[model samples]
Target: MMTIERLREEINKIDEEILSLLNSRASCARQIGELKQKNSLVTYHPAREKEIYRQLLATNHGPLSYDTICAIYTEIISACRGIESPLKIAYLGPEATFTHMAARRKFGSSVEFVPVASIADVFAEVEKKRADYGVVPIENSTEGVITHTLDMFIESNLTICAEILLEISQCLLSNSSLEEIRLVYSHSHAFAQVRGWLKSNLPTTKCIEVSSTAEASRRAAMEQDSAAVGSELAAQVYHLNIMAKGIEDRVDNYTRFLIIGHSMVGRSENDKTSIMFSVKDRVGALHSMLSPFNKHNVNLTKIESRPSKDTIWEYIFFIDMNGHIEDDNVKEAIDELRESCLYLKVLGSYPVAG
Candidate 1:
């Protein structure tokens, strides 16, 4: 028997209470920030943030889905964290790129986002303290690893603080109709992803390669009868209509981004550790390097090899494994791994991206 008028009145009352609670939370956050500053601690903690999300999601039995709860809390946390200290994050781009999106996903919208020209620029920003952290694409499901990113780690002192896993959905953005489109601008990777779609749909349209999807959208906006293969966010940022969406050859395409910073992240319940090493130049050296992991019952999630730029034909092996470096099993395995390798470096141990 509740009338719409009565329900709206109740909603207004709840909103007022919600505002009050938010202010209280912000006040608490401010106090914590003061303490952190005094003690010389970093503002962001991956494990702490993950614990908050896990607790909220575990208790949620809702009229709203878990995704909805996460979305709401992300903004709320962003606002609260901004009250503490505004973080400056650098990403590869002119804005609206997947790396930008991934940076936003981890830090939220309240922080400052600096879009740079390239992945190396992103690293340089954080290294020089121009930005608090940098987000760069490490690998893509369709195109494989980004070798440049791995190479940067070989010489940089930065640590992997966190990671972001984002699903890539290519969209065709244009000012004109699909039939009127003459040129398509996008990154080489995007072109590779949507090759099949472009072949079938716009076989004759001239495709131009640009630095990024955001740049492509910008070019599409300026040129007549032009389109760009990019993200829906690019469409929004560059003020273009989405002519088509989900145009990638593979529907399951995803990209993994790494958050690099000066501070090391503490361990979480579910964690991943990344390491790089060069095996000794001898028979069965590679096998000897991997045996310790099996002996310690540690699970390796991924392994990739890159040329050691210093020496010809020599390679460095990068690996991702489950568990924190502080864990006894992982620690022991790494000790064993070091014995079989010419050199070993522990990149970081961070909470696995959800």
Candidate 2:
């Protein structure tokens, strides 16, 4: 058996080799980026990324799981992206928000991060090309949907390139002694999700609404008599003590985030397509819009409506289906829906998460 010193030496050699290879890979990527730029092509190619991950997973030998390998490669790719130009990613922020965490998980630490004030800002950044991509929350298992994000999607031309599901754990943070806490601050959604827990544990504490959980954390960090209900990451970001952890009423809480970019991605075997459409204002109009999916045997994963800002009492329906737009059945269904709708837009077709 090798001694500890020998193992350390081997690790150092491997590290040096990895670094050398990475530099070579980055050089190639830079050349590729230059060529793409000459042709006026987009930087992020979701289809290529999906293919790379699929091939890597197929050839993977254990010791590291497929997910672990994919994660490492994602970081490596993000670093190589700088050879083209550092990708600017916008997220709902004030740092340590779940959207920030999702951005990090998806793009790694190499991309330049922009902390935007609202979901609309996130969409606008990508739409205006100020950022290469933007990350925004779309839905939560417990709270249903982020209506603001969906509303923005209906009006934007941006495409969904990827999706990430993050497990949420709401923590109670305070600078005060637990017994001295008289109020708790958090976003309204977080409060609603944890209402039962708050009522049972801190009935006397007043629940205050803030712009965001990160903001709530900041408030709790400053006020000795107050607590903030937020993520564990928010506590660390704001330098507050955790008075309680996992305070959300639901243990299975998870939020789904969408990665939006300027162009549509190529198709993948495991892909999902998102679209928005407005139906005619008549009885069974909505039913007519959905019948095509049933006829074409397309699996509808989600459907939600938001009031159209363009017209009063008129609404836009956002639909998520479990196949790429390139699929024959999906194409047929889209054609049929388009015929029935006043306006329709196929947002994007992108790879599904493993």
Candidate 3:
């Protein structure tokens, strides 16, 4: 049998090798970053990162699980990218908010997180070249799409470079016991998500809506008889105790966040393109326009409509399809789609959320 000391020695050798390899990787990344800056190219390449993740996961034969390996490499990539300069990620935040969490999850700890006031501000920051990228909530599993985020895309001149799917787990945080909790604070969305649970558990607790979960946590931390419904991170940030965890009514609450940037992302191994179009006013016009997708054998994952803020009674159709914009079939389908439409816009083509 192998001795413990021998096994440790082997591990130490591997550790030294990993350290050397990481520094070498970071040096290469720095060179790439310099080239990118010289040529005015985008440093945060989502497609390249996605491809790396795909390759690593495919070859990962582990004592560690798939998620563990992914997480490890994500940080490794983040660190390498930071060697040039830490990417500034603007997110909707007060801090400890879900969007902030998603941004951190995607970019890892090596980057900087700038908290913005609203979704519009997130777009403005990226558009003005202030933030390297902006993350905004696109949709939620339980509550459906965020209209404000969809609305911002209408005129924002930004592109979706990546997508983040964050599993939202709400916690009941308080300084006092459940019975002692008289007032509950959280964002309106959180309150809505856990309304059923709240009604059953703390029927008389005064529920107040706050700007963000971080703000709610602050209030909870200050108040003697208050509780907050948010993440465990929020609890930690504000020094509140987690009274209960996973308190949302639905077990599978999830929020999808979009990474927005000035430039378009290149195609990844598996890609999804988002597009929006306004149809001409005619009977059967909408039906005829959609046929091309089916005829071209393009698979549309989602279709949503928002009132065209430009014209009254008119609507814009936002579509998510299972291919890149550079694909021949995708191009053909869009060309066919444009023939009957008043206006068409490609939002972005990016790697589908893992």
Candidate topping TM-score:
1
User: Tens-digit lDDT track for model 2 on 160-185?
Assistant: 98898888899989889878999899
Badly placed stretches (over 4 Å) of model 1 are none
Worst 10 residues of 1 by lDDT: 279-288
Model 3 residue 56 distance off true place after TM-score fit, in angstroms: 1.7
- How many pairs in model 3 have backbone atoms within 3 A of each other, for residues 3 or more apart or on separate chains, i.e. clashes? 0
Q: What is the C-alpha lDDT of each candidate?
A: 0.93, 0.90, 0.91
lDDT of model 1 at residue 45? 90
Tell me the deviation in Å of residue 80 in model 3.
0.5
For every model shown, what is its TM-score relative to the native structure? Answer: 0.98, 0.93, 0.96
Model 1 agreement with the true structure over 1-354: per-residue lDDT tens digits: 999999999999999999999999999999999999999999999999999999998999998998888878888888888888999999998989989888887888999999999989999999999999999999999999999999999989899999999999999999999899999999999999999999999999999999999999999999989999999889999899998889999999999999999977898899999999997567787887899999999999999998888888788999999999999999999999897688899999999998
Clashing pairs in 1: none
Best by lDDT: 1
